[model samples]
Target: MNPETIRRRRWYILGVLTFSLLVVVLDNTILNVALKTIADPQEGLGATQSQLEWAINSYTLVFAGLLFTFGVIGDRLGRKRVLVAGMVMFGLASLLSAYSQSPAQLIGARALMGLGGAAIMPQTLSIITNVFEPQERGRAIGIWSGAVGLAIGIGPITGGLLLAHFWWGSVFLINVPVIVVGAVLIALLVPESRNPDPGRLDPVGVLLSIVGLVTLSYGIIQGGERGAWLEPGVLGPIAAGLAVLALFARHEARSDHPAFDVRLFRDPRLSAAVAAIALCFFAAAGMFFFAGFYLQSVRGLSAFQSGAMLLPFAVAQILFSTRSAAMVHRFGAKAVCATGLLLVAAALASYPVLGIGTGTPLWVLGAVFFVQGAGMANVMPPATESVMSALPREKAGAGSALNNTARQVAVAMGVAVLGSVLASIYRGELAERLAALPPGARTVAAESIEGAHAVAERLGAAGQGLIGPANAAFTEAMRTAAGAAAVIAFLGALVVLKWMPGRTAHREPERAERAERAERGTGREKARGRRAASRERTRV
Candidate 1:
């Protein structure tokens, strides 16, 4: 086959893979708006704070726990087969989630969906690696990465629109058509690909990793709400989780066919790109997660309203992301990424100051996110392109998995770390501010922020007087949390600037060469056609 033919086929494959990933990415943000509606049908199913936590965390736990194992399985079985099977599982789980009778059932179904997601996400990039020649892979990855931002942008709007018009179950139900369409297209279009030197799956490694991640996540989630950091309930799981993770690392080093690829970190560009993924996820996840609460609880926006409020971030991400490849080509990795990080930090830092009054203009909030979104658009695509393009072609499965694993770990940790920061400040501020009030009022104010209505019920008439102080205290806590988030964002930026290479090395350089050749080929084709037409006229 001609080079041009091969290039066209590769792009077609990329489309199928992108569709597969869209399911996983959409799931991540779709639940944000539906949480209240899902938990509170018929005036609410009496869902508790813990249940709400599990609703979100359950999906992440299973997804993160199984990612490495599934990656290896994809390498062993074939990415195409694994991707199909995963889509089926995801569809089934979504149906079950819609029918969940209680919070437990919903959480359980969501976990199942996560398992399916783990199967789906890694294969998209791996398939891109399989199909695209090295030179074109960066551009392909740029489009793939942009699709993620697109899914997120669409998720909130879709979720809100559905939830407002239909039921909470509508969110999960919406996935059905998408899955069916993707499955049909992939079945017809995508080809099978797998690892050349496939190895045995390590069950021990999977067990240890899952246990550790779950325990650590549990501690973080609970610590934020219940002050479990000071108690055995929080510390025990966290400590145990770390111990298990340590054991897994040691075991991987000793194993002949380890599930996790410890060797991928040996490459400087790959390592830097992975770290950037972690940081990108950490800041992005934290900002979005808390931004939900800030809109609803503090700003008094409803689910639909909050979803609408996130438009600036979503719009900017979609609009700017398509141009990321050109920007990377122009500015280089270090300059573009550093600029993105700084913008993100500035936006996060502005959150606290803006939280000061009830009259905070919606336009100002939107403007901050618009800038933040544009910065993020610059950072993610190049970083992802760099990482996937650096790996040897055969190692695509493992490399893609590792890239995603860093993102998942960062996402889980963000909820724990940044969520705890916000929760701790809120609890402390509330305690101090409410101290002089009546004992009952103080107790009412101390209930979980998730259950703030309970506190209002307890306060009775006295609640009116305390509202001003409580509002002031909550504003102060939000400001403090945003300040901390700013530091974290800045640190993430510094890491990107200091570590990620200004130029692509190894596979990346080769890919660039190929793109130049392809461009030359197109020019030659045009010139040949012009000469042939002129000669034909002379002959006539």
Candidate 2:
């Protein structure tokens, strides 16, 4: 092919990657706007708090657990081939999720969707990592990471529109056509690629990782529901999960060919990059998790209005994402990433302090979202560039999987952990306050904010009194949850500043090669000088 055509194809390849990726990424937060509708007992599936958590967590848990397994599988198989198959799987799973009647069935379908997403996510990044050269990789990754914000932006809006017109199922169903189009584009435009020397499949590692993630998530969800960490339901699974993950580590530490190398964390850049992305997502997930209810339930905004309200965040994300690659080059990953983390920390910390009421505080809250969006935009693209640059092309799949796994795990925990904190506080606030109601009604009211609203609706004018206290209680819970997410983000900022490499991160190889050349030159000079000295001695 001519140079011009080849150059153009690469960007076309990027387009293909982004669309396929959107199919997976959009589903994650798309359901957030629809959660209220889904939990409506009259018009939709009546899912409880635990079940609602599962709706999101099931996808993330399975996605996180299987990422490395499938990454390796994709490396052994053809990336393009596996990608097509994953798209097919994702489409089918979305159909199941869209049609499922019960919460359990929806969860199962989401899990299947996650299984397909696991196959897709790593390959997208790994392919970009391999295809793009060092000079261009940052820009490529920036555009790639931008797609995430795009998905997040479009998800709520599209979900809101769909919910306004159609059933909750339409959100999942929409992915089918997108995935089909993406698959066709891939078949035509994308090149097949994989690791030539991919290692043997690690069944033990896969089993351990899957079990560890599932159990860990289960524990957190259980703890959130029960609000007791010491109970068997919480402690047992947590301990078991930790133990299994530890074993998985030990196994990797000893293995000749580890599925995902634990040693990558030895490089502070990669580790810190992973940490930064995970924590940012943690705050983002928690924010959106409550923002949905806070907007629709407490503030009385329609889902479409809520989606519109979030436009500032999406716009900020887009603006910053466009500039992040250049910013990374200008400021370097360490500084850019650290600053971004601090902004997210500040935004989150302000969450509780800022009121949801439509006044000056709400405007302040929008400003915070704008800043936080810019902050996240700075973090992911640079962090991805840093991590992918650190790895050799051959190991891109594993490295990408490791990076993505951290992100998926963080997302799941974001919902599970932060949601747990929110849940506990929301439930506690309602407990004694809700005690006045009948046993069944009180229990239902205390289960979730949505349930409280439902109970209030059912009780007629008498329940009108409950809205003030319930919303206030829920808002208080949100503040506490936001505070916790802030702390995590702040800590991540510290980690980035302290551990991540500076402007010279990209030039390390050139620096190393220069040092070797200098040493060789010095050796040659010494050898010449010694020979001259010996010749002079012989003449004497």
Question: Among these predicted structures, which one has the highest TM-score?
Answer: 2
Please provide TM-scores, in order, for all candidate models, with all chains considered together.
0.88, 0.92
List the lowest-lDDT window of 10 residues for candidate 2. 354-363
lDDT string for model 1 (1-540, tens) is 345554667777787788878888887687776654554436344454446666767787678767777878888899889999999999999999888888889889998998899899888888888788665666788788878877776787777787778777778888888899998988887878789887788888778877888888788777876755879888888898899989988888888877676776777667777777677677767667656556766677877787887788878887878787777787777677777778878887887756644568888888987887887787777777777767667878777888888888877787667767666666787775567666764544554343443455556875555555555555666677667767777887787777777854433586667789989999999999999999999999
Go through the candidates in order and give the C-alpha RMSD of each one to the true structure: 5.2, 6.3
lDDT of each: 0.75, 0.85
- Candidate 1: C-alpha RMSD to true structure equals 5.2
Compose the digit string of candidate 2's lDDT tens values, residues 17-132: 99899879888768988888888887679998789888998898888878887888889998888889999999999999999899999999999999999989998888787677
In model 1, the runs with Cα more than 4 Å from the true position are 1-6, 38-42, 353-357, 432-450, 454-471, 504-508, 511-540
Backbone clash numbers for all candidates listed: 1, 0
Segments in model 2 whose C-alpha atoms lie over 4 Å from true places: 1-6, 355-362, 509-540
Clashing pairs in 2: none
